[model samples]
Target: MTYVFNPTYQLLVLASAFAAVHLLASGRTFIFASHTILFAALTAVLVSHGIEPYQTTAQAPGGLWVKLFYGAAKATWWIGGALMLVSSVRLFLIFEGRPREGRLVQDLLAGLIYTGAALSIVAYVFNVPVGTLIATSGVIAVILGLALQSTLSDVFSGVALNLGRPYSVGDWIILDTGVQGRVVETNWRATHLLNGTNDLVVIPNSTLAKSQLVNQSSPDETHGVTLTVRVITSRSPTQIQQVFSTILLGGRHTLREPAPLVTMGEMDGQSIGVELAFRVADAGQIITAKNEMLDLIFRHLKAEGLALATSVPNLGVPLNITSIGSAAADPSDQHDAIRDVPLFAALTENELNLLTQGVTRKTYARGTEIIHQGEKSGALMVVTRGVVIVEKELGNSRIELNRLSPGDFFGERGLLMGAEEPGFIRALSQVSVLEITSEDLSKILHARPDLADDLGATLAARLDAEAEYGVATPSMRRPLTIAHRIRHLFQL
Candidate 1:
């Protein structure tokens, strides 16, 4: 004869079914395997309760109590199964990496599941019918919704934003309020942005959804950035084009497909303004690229004997011939001394004035010891007016290392390295020098570290090139000779 299951056994079967559903949704193979064992145990317990030789009387209070317990357990099982299904779907969406749309859907579904579970558990425990509890909850929900309308609007707006995909994390956006930044996080109530200064800006999701936004990363990641260069009108348009093209080709960041555009923008009084338009990969690198491009442009122009425009007003006054002669008689002649210095090249009148304040003017007669060998000197000397011979004592003979003219500086190595003078400097002609002490150089460097780095790099390069080639006579004006030029051309 087939055995009829008792109420207690029925309750155990219902609970086991709920547990099995939860385990299946958990999606773990080993955990699912364990759930089979649990299911078997529950079945064994149910079978043992049913097969008991001794049975409780139908009229006994214990039988009625067991029936009530079974009813409650069955309700709990149903509630738990509903919650598990909702939670499982939500978790699956999250794990699949569909956070934008998935999170909102998950939150809504989970909230409903929790509300249902809370009501069901309470009703089951209190012996209240599910229909009556759900009716009461509906009325309470209506009252709460009225009070939280604005807050609810934000929550719903957040959901809309997730679905719309207006902007995602890591995208750079400019809001309608002129606030610009990268999106860092999105939540049910608000979105967070990291501004340029790296400050976090929390904006309401409703506000963001309503405002217009510009996504810099959209369409394409490439951005067109322009650099403007002002050149002297004296430089021919053709030559300017060639020079700019060469510079663009040398730049690592410049895109070749678009070909850097060089347009003559406007003609100013002293300069022919030009705009250099090019495509760059990112906005952050614009400043660095601007600096390097300007440096390269200036260096190329200087090498090509091109001049940039200036806007300084000059005071027209005739020089006193007598004063000029008197000034010429001084150890360092100011006018002639400034002519040959490449370092002073392209400096404006105001810049020259600022330079003069820190410089000491000195005049040297022929054979005068400008710098004594083995002496500690604090100043770097620039040949402003005449030639100076740099000579080092080698054995008994004095080897002439170089002849420096206007624009050339000496004592740089000693000043930079804090070394004693290694060679003697004498006037090849009556020379004038504008001296910059180590202290002044340091102050200038502190004020402009970029200039200091450029100068340091240039000096190091010159030193390396000189060491590779034998030291030349101080009487030689040009640093490079024909043979040196040829070797440089052929050398790898």
Candidate 2:
């Protein structure tokens, strides 16, 4: 090892050490950095030892055995230099932007570099004629190219796609051939996509190159959704527009910048037509946004005493939540909303009416703060119209905890346990709610003791949800602890 320090062997020893480090760094981030160092060391060693890898008649230095070792070392040095060239191309890609999309170009360049290095080794080390070799290889290339015509087309098409960057990995694309999916991988021959059903789809680059494609994530990630709704003449056109406007404002899954739109269409003797057009964050959010908007439509319509046209077509759009909000809610809207409440699903008809009687209806416009974070409210509130978003602040970031629609409940923690809210609740649109004071809710809990069991479990779940969103709460005793608290608070 001490010989490494001797001037005669120092350059060789340093080159060998750099090569070892480069090999050790393979498959890691340090490989590219280490490759550069090894390349420089190899170049220095070859130049110092009077061995030129590029010179066809370059002598290997010393005796036969030493010449043999020098030949191998010179070949290794050429390969190292090729790798350094490849590394520079990759570094250029990082600076050029779109490192991910430029991978195909980088790889193709690396292959060419290695090929050139191989040709150089043949001429310089073996003293072979490259002109004859190039001529013979041209004939073989034509034959292979003809045999693998389709594959070659795909390879070239992939190169074109990477250079043009029509779509990158993670973009949702739809081919004219009716194939729609998110791009998960792209290789030499094909683009792999993960479809909505979680199935992997591989399409040859040749086909993708020819087929017309719509990139849903292009220009931006936001995608538009259009829904047509028909309403009976029971409500005015102005009223319908106002309610639909509220839906867009309250939508949590939709984008805000592009701004949602509502257009009044032709009206017939049976009903009036309206189109609700909005843009969601992405194609993946379309269904969620639709469902939430539909629910809000029903709740708002029911609260405002508007009804869907009797002749409204099914249109293949499945209405998931049924049996409660289907009919027009006018004379007893509060009673029906209370009946549909999941928390009071098991309550007697008379009990529901009793709770409904005590509720004081309240309303708020868009952007109004309904419940402030850390505020203690002595009343229980149930949403009767529109939507509200619950948001919590954690240091510098503010996260939306949840969105509440009609019939959903809140303020239980304050009313039952007299605790502060885990987050602030703000009205996303024109909102209306039925507020039940502690005195009113207490009477109902005392009247129906069985309700204590259900409300307690529901309240515990609500608190648990808040705890998950950067808030702290006690280890709630699912139903029992909450029920006991209700009894103590209300003196039941």
What lDDT does the true structure give each of the candidates? 0.61, 0.77
Give me the runs in candidate 2 sitting further than 4 Å from their true place: 1-23, 26-29, 58-67, 95-97, 310-328, 363-373, 387-403, 422-431, 439-492
Please provide, for model 2 over 1-492, each residue's C-alpha lDDT reduced to its tens digit, 9 standing for 90 to 100. Answer: 011112236546756766676566554346667778777776776676565666766564467866666567668878788877777777775514657667788889989999999998888888889889999899899999999999999999999998888999889999998999999888899999998889999999999999999999988899999989877765678988887787676677877778899998988665787899999888878778899888777766666667776452567543232222555556246777777677777778888877777788888998899889899877788887778888887788778877787778888888888888878889887778888887777677888877777888887777676676647557564668889887877777
**Root-mean-square deviation of Cα positions for candidate 2 versus the true structure, in angstroms:** 5.0
Compare the candidates by TM-score and give the number of the best one.
2
Highest-lDDT candidate: 2
Error of 1 at 26 (Å): 12
Q: Encode model 1's per-residue lDDT on 31-51: one tens digit a residue.
A: 444445444454455445443
Note the residue pairs that clash in candidate 2: none
Q: Residue 163, candidate 1: how far off, in angstroms?
A: 0.7
After the best TM-score superposition of candidate 2, give how far the Cα of residue 135 lies from its true spot, in angstroms: 0.7
What clash count does candidate 1 reach?
Answer: 11
